[model samples]
Target: MHVQNKKRFYLMVGLLIVVILLVGFSIYMIWSDISSSNAPVQTASNTTNTANADSSQGNRTDITASQAITNPTDLLVLVNKTTSLDENYQPSDLVWVDLPGVRETQLRKEAATALEDLFAAAELKNLSLYCCSGYRSYQTQEELYAENVKTYGQKEADLVSAKPGQSEHQTGLAMDVTAESVNFDLLESFGQTTEGEFIKNNAHLYGFIIRYPEDKTAITGYAYEPWHLRYVGKDVAAEIDKNNLTFEEYLKTS
Candidate 1:
């Protein structure tokens, strides 16, 4: 009877040890699974923080597409204005003939003064920048269009010159500038000379922008014209330049 009781006690002891071991293994497995799940979350959070820091450090300017144009009214002015032949078309017309003045007509008086300053600056370097075309009239635009169609065919002429009433030149805020030897021939000399590059790069400082840049041909509906500068004020020009957007793209976002 004593041996049987001892045997029974030993059996109970072994079962208790086995149950404890199983409980311990289950606890360890649950802990390990929880730790593994938490590790990925921690890594993901660190990666996100690093990416945000890197983006902030890389760019000082707010160059998002929405920041390109601040004024919505400016776009309305550009689209509502009529273009003239003398200002943007071939066989230039007289400056004061049109009822609605060209973009130069409405430009801040300071703009003209700035042109004078620009000329003076250019003179120092023996680089002559002259305004070949400033403002144009609707009648002048019509005549120019007729002539273009006669000379270059409708399709070819349309590529270079806008039809009457559809031009940006009528705003009196645009100008066609040319170097001394290449006067009025801005179309042929874009990106070829130092003067062209200078105007293209620095025109924004004076509240002017290349109306039709090379990369934005599709948007502007015209080929690149390095010498054509549109005045939209200094702040707007700076934003446009920084964002690298065409006027059309700026309009869409704004």
Candidate 2:
């Protein structure tokens, strides 16, 4: 009887030892799995932060060059010196007749010449283009703003016209072109026309670009104006056109 009791006690001890070993192994495996699951999340967070830092570093590198001026105030001066546009928002008073007999004034001689070259290159075909607006003086801009406010109210007018000195037209680097058939109305439908497409594809060759492209309204501070072209000169315009960038982006890169 004593031998049988001892045997039973030994059997119970063996069973308890086996259960403890199984429980410990299970706990260890669970801990390892949890640790493994967290590794990918940690790696992803590190990668995201690293990518943002690299992008910021690249932007800083672009600005570090002596010739590359990124600040709008400094860039305005650089662009004015580099191009034919008037400095300090002064526009030329000379008005020239364009291809379709539209009398238009340009801010500079270079702007007129560039337009003439572009017009000559255009096939025209059945399409006739007219220059509606070119340069604007401080007074002219104020008058336009007043008129817009009367017609569209203050808020709406502000969107369509710049506040006097802030306008690109005041610098004489920009122009407004339109289809003669449409009476120079700026519209997206014009972009679908062959003449529009031609201008879109070839304007960069003559140192011009569509100032407010459809995709870049947020950056340009204006709605899409297919007719508005800004002259930054051939080299810069070509780069902007080729890279599919806004003047703001081009300014940053410069």
Candidate 3:
């Protein structure tokens, strides 16, 4: 009887040890799971990246976020990534463009007249230039920018598209031009076509300038858009072209 009791006590001790081991393992597993659950999970869409000016573009002006632009109606008003026009701002003199285009668009009366002359001059040279886009509203720009972000991701979209209220098109002075040689699409290769070269050389004669030049992408915060023209009046446009300055640079020194 004594031997049997001792045997039972030993068995109980072993079973208790096993139970304690199992409990400890479960506690450790729970703690590990809790730690993993608390950790951060980074995703492509959630990652934040602040945009910095390209060093090659020269020292970028540190603009206050959502800075108010008071000269929204000025022909040379500056709009960019930092500065923004009012969401409700629309040009009072907006007029439908009579020039050939991919879609119906409008620009300020003065800019519309300038664009007409530019197109007519191109026609004289047998260089068929078509308006791709012009005079975007804040809402339209928002939707367009959202679409771009969905398609290209935020980082890439920022490089190619402007946020709402930050676009120059909102001022009714900017136009995106294209040609049949490139299927009437906005493309960098359009800069190499005959129409592109003609516009680059002579657009200023009609009160426009290649707003974003090939070599000034850094300063402009945009890619080389030879097709994008901004009407800044004949004198300002001529000075900008002659000095080989982007509109941003011209504004700084002027």
Candidate 4:
């Protein structure tokens, strides 16, 4: 009888040890899963998070300098001094800009439609906006850069003209706008004109932005070019305008 009791006690103790081990393992697994779930939700792939309502209140990761963009077809492609499009990158949906008697330039289909609306709205308010240039191919930009070098010398040219693959024009997402107020010339002075003021105030409503603003030369690595307009979609444009952020800054924060 004593031997049987001792045997039963040992069996009970073994079963209790097994239960305790099982519970401890389950707690450890649950803790591990919770830690993983609470990790960062940001990704380098999305480039920037959408400008949420609480845009001012988040732990936004800065957009680091990256190589060529992986997806050129994405509407919000970041092409600037640091990032270059490949020699062969081209918009598949290029369409002629439909503003009356404007330059024979083309923009991406969605951009073209938004540009037409922008122009029409400007006309309604007695402002005359002109499209001076758009969508320069890699070869065209190379030739233009050479011409600029001859006219302005290399140092001056580099400030205004982009090297072949580094131009926003290559993305088919930008246009050089002008007005008779500035004699259809792309000049920094244009930003001071009444027509320019209209554009600066309203371009965001139409999905356009004054790509390079004055005093932002340090960030953009280019001189101020108020004439250059880039399409980044209305919501993005509005957020950029509202926050007084360069697209680079916007990408970094939001």
Go through the candidates in order and give the C-alpha RMSD of each one to the true structure: 15.6, 17.3, 16.5, 10.2
- What C-alpha root-mean-square deviation, in Å, does candidate 3 show against the real structure? 16.5
Q: Write the per-residue lDDT of candidate 2 for residues 27-76, one digit (tens) a residue.
A: 99999999998785544877899767644431232342233333322223
- How would you encode candidate 1's per-residue C-alpha lDDT over 106-222 as one tens digit per residue? 332444555556556656777666675664555666788789899999888876776775566554556677765564375657556777877767777877777888767677777
In the range 1-254, model 3's lDDT, one tens digit per residue, is: 35658878999999999999999999999999999999997665533332232211111223322221445766767888878889999988899999889999999998999899988988888888899899999999999999999999998898789999999999999999999999999999999999999999999999898988997767888878888898888888898889998877777676
Model 1 regions more than 4 Å off = 1-76, 80-110
Q: For residues 1-254, write the lDDT of model 4, one tens digit per residue.
A: 35668878999999999999999999999999999999988776554443342242212223232311545655566787778889988888899987753468999988889899999998999888899998999989989999999999999998898988889998898999999988888899999998889889999999998888889978887899988999888888899899998978877776
Supply every candidate's count of residue pairs whose N, Cα or C atoms clash at under 3 angstroms. 7, 0, 0, 0
My TM-score estimates for the predictions, one after another, are 0.58, 0.62, 0.73, 0.73
Q: Which regions of candidate 2 deviate over 4 angstroms?
A: 1-89, 92-101, 124-126
Off by over 4 Å in 3: 1-68
Root-mean-square deviation of Cα positions for candidate 1 versus the true structure, in angstroms:
15.6
- Which scores better on lDDT, 1 or 4? 4
Residue pair clashes in candidate 2: none
Q: What TM-score quantifies how close candidate 4 is to the native fold?
A: 0.73
Error of 1 at 108 (Å): 5.9
Local distance difference test, per candidate?
0.60, 0.68, 0.84, 0.82
Would you give me the overall lDDT of model 4?
0.82
Q: Give the Cα RMSD of candidate 2.
A: 17.3
